[model samples]
Target: MAEINVTPFVDVMLVLLIIFMVTAPLLASGVPVDLPDSRANPIDQQPDQVTISIDPTGTIFIGNERVETGGLPDALAAIDRGQAGNEPVIVLRGDRTLQYARVMAVMGELNRAGFSSISLVTNSSQSAP
Candidate 1:
C-alpha cells in the first residue's frame, strides 16, 4: 500500500485562499468615484441591481456603460425593457466632487423612468457617529 502526502497540497490551497481574501474587497471598486462619507448605516443590498454612476465631470453611466448626452430617459427606458419582470434596485453613485444639481438631475431621470427602488451609494464616515 502506497500513501501520498497531502501536506503540500493543503499548504498550496491555504496560500491561494489567503491571496483571494486579500483581493476580494478590491474587486468591487468599479468605476472610480470619490463618494461622500455618511454616518448612516449601509443598506442591505441585493445581488440583482443596476448601478448608475455619475463622475466628477457629470458623465453618466449605467453599470459601467456610458449614457449618451441628454439621452438618460431613453437609456433608462431601455434598461427597464431589458430587465423585463425583474425589478432591481437602481443604485446611484455620484462623485463627492460632483455638483448637487447633477446628482438631482440623475435622480429625476430615474423617477421619470419609473424606478422606485433607488439607493444612494456613499462611503462610510471615518469618524464615530
Candidate 2:
C-alpha cells in the first residue's frame, strides 16, 4: 500500500496562508491615507460602497481614479446612477496630516452631491495605557 505525503502539502498551504495574511490589509485600500486614530467602533463595509480617498497632498480619488475638486459631484453622480436602486454609501478616507478645511471641503462636496450616508474612515486607536 502507498501512502500520500501530506507533510509537504501542509507546509505549502501554511506558507500560502501566511503570504495572504500579510498582503490582505495592504490590498484593502488602493489609495494609502494615514488615517487618524479613533476610539469609535469600526463599521461594516458594504461591497458597493463608494470610497473617496484624500492623500496628504489634498488630492482626491474616487476609487483609484483621481478627480478634480470641482468634478467630484459629477463623478459621484455617475457612481450613484450605476448602483441601480440601492442607495450608495460614501466612505471618505482623509489623511491625518491634512487640514480640517480640506477634509471639510470634500465632505461639503459630497453633501452638495446629495449623498447623505457618508462615513469617515479612521484607524483604531492604540494606546499603551
Candidate 3:
C-alpha cells in the first residue's frame, strides 16, 4: 500500500499562514490621505465598503479606476440601481492638497446620486480620535 505524505504539505501551509498573518495589516492600507483633524469619533466599518479616491491632481478614482467627473453621477447611479438588498457604505478619500470646495462638490454629487451612507477616508496613522 502506498500512502501520500500529508505532513509536509500541512507544514508548508502553516508557514504560509504565518507569513500572511504577519503582513495582513500592512496590506490593508487604504488610499492614503492627509486628513484634517477632527474632534468627532471614528465610525465602525464593515467589509462591504466602497471607496472613491481623489488625488492631488483632482483626478477621481473608484477602486483604482479613473472616473471622469461627467460620468461620476451616472456611475454612482448605477451602483444605487444595482443594489439587491443591502446598501454598501461609500468612502471618499481625497488628497489634502485638494481644495475643500472640490471635495464638497464631489460629496454633493454623491448625495444627489442617492448615496446616503458615505464616509470620508483618512490615514489611520495621522488621524486623531
Residue 88's C-alpha lDDT in candidate 3?
84
lDDT digits (tens) for residues 73-107 of candidate 1: 88998874346666888989999999898899899
Best-performing candidate as measured by lDDT: 2
Q: With candidate 2 superimposed using the best TM-score fit, by how many Å does residue 118's alpha carbon deviate from the native?
A: 0.5
Index of the highest-TM-score prediction: 2
Which sequence of candidate numbers ranks them by TM-score, best first? 2, 1, 3
TM-scores, in order shown? 0.85, 0.90, 0.67
Question: In terms of TM-score, which candidate is stronger, 1 or 2?
Answer: 2
- Residue pair clashes in candidate 1: none
Q: lDDT tens string, model 2, 1-129?
A: 999999999999999999999999899899989999888788999987899999999999999899986787788778754555667789999999999999998899889878888999988987732
- Give the runs in model 2 whose Cα sits over 4 Å from its true position: 81-85, 127-129
lDDT at residue 10 of model 2 (Cα atoms): 100
Q: For each candidate, what is the lDDT?
A: 0.87, 0.88, 0.78
Write out the backbone clash pairs for model 3. Answer: none
lDDT by residue for model 3 (58-121), tens:
8777776778868888777766434566788888888888999989988999889777888986
Error of 3 at 128 (Å): 7.5
